[model samples]
Target: MRARILSVKVGHVTGLREQKKQATRAALGAAALRLAWERGPENVRVDDIAEAAGVSTRTYNNYFSSREQAIVAAVIADRESRVAAAVVGRDADVGLGEAVIDAVAGQYEDEGGRDALLMITGSPALRACYIDTVAAIEDPLAEAIVERCPGVDTLTAQVLSAGVGAAVKVALRQWLRPTSMPGFVMVSGSVTDLLRTALTPLRPALEAAGDTEVSRCRL
Candidate 1:
């Protein structure tokens, strides 16, 4: 009875710690974005972000590698987390290609997504950071892919996820380029169309790896 009570107490403490850490991280990212929007990326300093987040510069460094990463994190908000959740919530029978494509493309179907895209595309530095930020999705996505297809190896899942990341990078570069008129010109079609087209080459890999039979055979 004593051990059980202690265990519950420990679990509660750990949960609270995790929540606090997440709050700090979110605060730093939000501060970074707010500063960047007000002063532009080139002018926003690490100290400024730290001050706005109500933490020391050292604490800010603990959360992000650089100011750009923090800004990108703020810009992305929780969309990557949403993508992973969406993928995880899908029916087990859904093919990897369909699951991933839909999860990513579905994010852009909302008004908030459109605003993020416009904000990101308007600045070259932020756009580049946006492209780089997609890499953050690889690990969680690979884990989710492997969970849905347990027969698939971790390495294979990682490779497929990397391919997906690369496709997104390429597609965004094409879709967010600047025009002579100034500001970002939306490329000719929907971002969803561009993403799907970019992702088309990975269909074979996604299908084969996601197939239970193929996964088992390779194992």
Candidate 2:
């Protein structure tokens, strides 16, 4: 009982630390975005961001290594709230693929909308930062899939998630470039179509095989 009490105390301490960290990160991110919006990405400096966030420039450095990272933190914050709360049991009917589509569409629709799309197509800094963010998005989707699909096994879930993540990134990259369709429809159709076209028959077949394997194990 004493050991259990100790463990609980440790867990509480850890949670407090995480909460503080998240608060700091959010403040810094807000400062960066405010500065970026006011002066554009190029004019914003780390000191300006630190001042706006009410943190020391050193604290800003500790949270984000660069001005670009500050921008990224802002981008992620804007996107995260919109990401469908479909991680595992939050919405059992929502498959990871569909959930991902919903989440990404939200990002594409926000402040990083059509105009940001055009800017990203040309801006080297935005491009580099987006590439990094895509990888981060991919990892979480992978874990979410494993959590959502019981008996899916780790390796298989990881591989499937990776393929889905890659497809989403590719579609996002394409959509980020063109304004071909009537506003939002362009990306929605393009991304879903791209994934469907690329993985059509192969994906279904693999899924069936996986199901059979799982069933056999159960038997």
Candidate 3:
């Protein structure tokens, strides 16, 4: 589990084996996403994902309980890559406004990043599963928020976390839908305009939040 691994990294030794396991798990996830794309998530199978990843079905079982978990893994992996990139660019010198601008704008610039949005938008079951994942993230998210924003209540943290999660996702969903022409350019403009209006009060913080560098705990 992510929680256990974090605890271990705090004290327990990290080993090559653990690293390999993580790599294999990631491969399995990529495989699952590929299958989901090829044939809707509902039709995708655990064995198919495992075979695509070139790992055994048993290994797949060890890592994920079902195809949905693998979809979750793919979503999580994309987020990890984005956050890792964001942290690299983040600094105390950057104003919250610019950060927010960057975060919101990055959604438009990253053409490759639309896959998750497309997957969620295209599949009803995956969308529901993603909602469940959002619900489950409260505990860990609140813990992280407490560390960053001292004096916050865990309950409030959870609510804030889930609200933000829902907002970002809804924003993406609206953007992805064809109410507008073309893909991201229109989507980007609309989301930017909507977000700009919605978070006008905390524009700077929102801009800072907009930076793709923090967490996809939302989308």
Residue 13 miss distance in model 3 (angstroms) = 5.9
For model 2, what is the alpha-carbon lDDT of residue 168?
A: 56
lDDT of 2 by residue, 1-219 (tens): 999999999999999999998898989888886787778878889999999988899988898888877776776663533432444434544444545545444454444455554444455576567656655555565555555555666676567656655665666565554454432223444444554554443355334423554523211
Q: Which residue pairs overlap in candidate 2's backbone?
A: none
- Angstrom error of the Cα, residue 163, model 3: value is 5.7
The C-alpha lDDT values of all candidates are 0.80, 0.60, 0.57
Quality of model 3 by C-alpha lDDT: 0.57
For model 2, the run of ten residues with the poorest summed lDDT: 210-219
Off by over 4 Å in 3: 1-13, 56-58, 84-88, 91-93, 104-119, 130-163, 173-219
Can you write out model 3's per-residue Cα lDDT over 1-219, one digit (the tens) per residue? 999889888654557677888899889888888888788888898889999999899999998888987886777554433422442345656543444335434533433356775666565565556545534434444454444334445665565545545555555555544434432222345555554444344444333343344432222
By TM-score, the candidates rank as 1, 2, 3
Best by TM-score: 1
Q: Candidate 3: which pairs clash?
A: 86-213, 99-207, 99-208, 100-207, 100-208, 101-207, 103-210, 103-211, 104-210
Task: List candidate 1 segments past 4 Å from native.
Answer: 1-13, 110-113, 178-188, 214-219
| TM-score of model 2 vs. true structure | 0.72
- The TM-score of candidate 3 is 0.55
lDDT value, residue 211 of candidate 1: 71
